[model samples]
Target: MPRFAANLSMLYNEHGFLDRFAAAARDGFKAVEFLFPYAFAPAELAARLQDNGLRQVLFNAPPGDWDGGERGIACIPGREAEFRDGFLRALEYAQALDCPRIHVMAGLAPVGRRREELKATYMENLGWAARQAAKAGRSVLLEPINTRDMPGFFLNFQEEAHRIVEDIGAKNLLVQMDLYHCQIMEGDLAARIRKYLPTGRVGHFQIAGVPGRFEPDVGEVNYAYLFGVIDEAAAQCGWDGWIGCEYKPRRGAVPYGTGEGLGWLRSPVLPGV
Candidate 1:
């Protein structure tokens, strides 16, 4: 089975941001990832990781003016300079946390910008970011968020994400395939993984229950079998990365002995050592 990491941003929201590290560690997660880390000091975050014996596996580049409704700035036509700055800031945090993967959010397309032009800008920014990350020995990841959840998001389809990676021709750039988003957009989860995994183009993977983004145990997707597929495909291709559990644990989604919605990590269904 593939190694799994918890997405602290969505998983441990019951606790404060800093407190989530300890919470994750207490719940048996050895690695974690989050949407963004610009709010806290990298040194402090690193200290928490060290104290909890958890590895910071991944985090996103700063989303532009998040409160002002910006998901990312990479796809905006005139935000090239802002994109570069945001990437540098994220790189600083990643280095401090010993994180090797950074997912670049393709922000919403500007209201009247030509689609072709915006795509060009997106390609340019991604290529530039890839080269910079390569120099630092890190990989840049791109994810295809479903349009239903994040309307106007520039990168919305798995095919488009793969195309962008090919167009940029950057060896350090790869796709961050989020399983929840894939189920929301398309249904052939196992086939997609088998197709992408063999090419060594998938950098990382994420999971959440489908239909409501709840516990994977009761979702439309058969995570247990799917985990087997992911493991088999990655083993065949020699891919090394964590499958992050990014889901919301509602109050009564499933039975829990420890008062946490971790059905996916339980024995019989979860991967074994």
Candidate 2:
């Protein structure tokens, strides 16, 4: 069976951010991931993780002016200094939190900007970030988000992300494959998983229902079959990574709706249930 991590940003919304840790732990998740941790002190977040016995599997680096709609600055020319500073700050948080991976969002491609220019900047920044992360015994992740949900996201395909990782030749730089986005942009989920898992380029995964972005079970994608594929591929590739439950609760934030919607986790399709 695959280990699961609750995305506190989307799940457990019934409670405050801090309180969501305990709620996730109470519902049987041993690991967790969130969008960002800059809002709270590192020490405070660390205490929450320790108290709940949950591992911090992942979190994203600072995307420039999040409230003002900048998805990231890594690919935006002239923001190199800002991107480096933000990444270093994220690294400090990752080290303090004992988190192994930090996702570096490829900024939205600027309108009218040359693709080659943006690509050059993105690869350069990723290479630098990967080198920095290597020194700390940590890995940097790049996720290909669907343009539908995040219009203008710079990275939008698995092959494109893998190509960046390959071109950079940084072992510490890897891809974060979100199945939800994969289904949106491409349909061969199983084939893609089998193809990438053993290549050792994929470092993490996120899942949600199609159309609604709800719990995995509610989606048109057959998570049960996909989970089985993951188990087989993992056995062959020796990949033991966490699958982040990054989805909204269909039942809404009605106290235990998130927990209640976790029937898929308890199904016989997954082992150790």
Candidate 3:
């Protein structure tokens, strides 16, 4: 069976971190992924995972000024020190939580900056972060967000992300192809997955509806077909990874509707698995 991980941030917004972990476990999720867990100590988070029999699939490095519209700054010039500090802190948490992957937020490029200079800065900082993560036996991930939601954001398309990973030349650096953003930015989802699977650079996956970023069934993307494509690719390449459900609930989480919401995703990814 294709393993599914619940994105705690999107689900159970009513609960705190620990409560969300418990809720996910109750809902039959064997693994979980959080967007950012910097607010709590890693040791404490690890204990919660152990008690609940959950595995940490992925989490992101802290995006400085997340509330102030500074989503990330790793690729911006003159902010190298801040980026390094942010990554180091995330690495510490990853080690404690035994997380295998950490997503690196490229943030937005500075205004009036040439694309060449911005790309160079991004490569340099990623090299540094990749080395740091390697020492801990973990990989660094680069995610491509949609330009519609995040204007001026660097690394908004799959082709550009692939080129950046190739140029970095670090074994530990990989691409996180978020299907929702990819569908919004680039419509050919399965083709892009097949194109990047050969490189083994695609480290993680996330999904939601395109128009609303809500449950997969309500959107234009056919997840059943998408999962079939992914399963075929994984079999061809002998790859096993978690596919995360990172969608927002259509309504508040209630006992009556929660089952229907989750049941929509309960369909088997691979038949007879």
Whole-model lDDT per candidate:
0.86, 0.93, 0.85
TM-scores, one per candidate: 0.94, 0.97, 0.95
For model 3, give the 10-residue run with minimal summed lDDT.
Answer: 251-260
Q: How many backbone clashes does candidate 3 have?
A: 0
Top lDDT hit = 2
Q: How does candidate 1 fare on TM-score?
A: 0.94
What is the lDDT, from 0 to 100, of the residue 116 in candidate 3? 85
lDDT string for model 2 (163-259, tens) is 8899999999999999999999988999999999999999999999997899898869888888888989999989999999999998756645688
| Model 1 segments more than 4 A misplaced | 252-259, 270-273
Descending-lDDT candidate ranking: 2, 1, 3
User: Which pairs of residues clash in candidate 2, taking residues 3 or more apart in a chain or in different chains?
Assistant: none
lDDT of 1 at 215: 75
How badly does each model clash, as a count of residue pairs?
0, 0, 0
Error of 2 at 120 (Å): 0.3
**Residue 99 in candidate 3 has what lDDT?**
91
Model 2 residue runs over 4 Å out of place are 270-273
lDDT tens digits, residue span 1-273, model 1: 678888878876767789888988888889999999888899999999999999988999988898999999888887889899989998999899999999999988888889899888889999999999988889999999988888988887898899889878898899999999998888798899888888877999998888888877876888888888887887888887899988777763233322366745856364431
Q: Indicate the worst ten consecutive residues by lDDT in candidate 1.
A: 251-260
Give the C-alpha lDDT of model 2.
Answer: 0.93
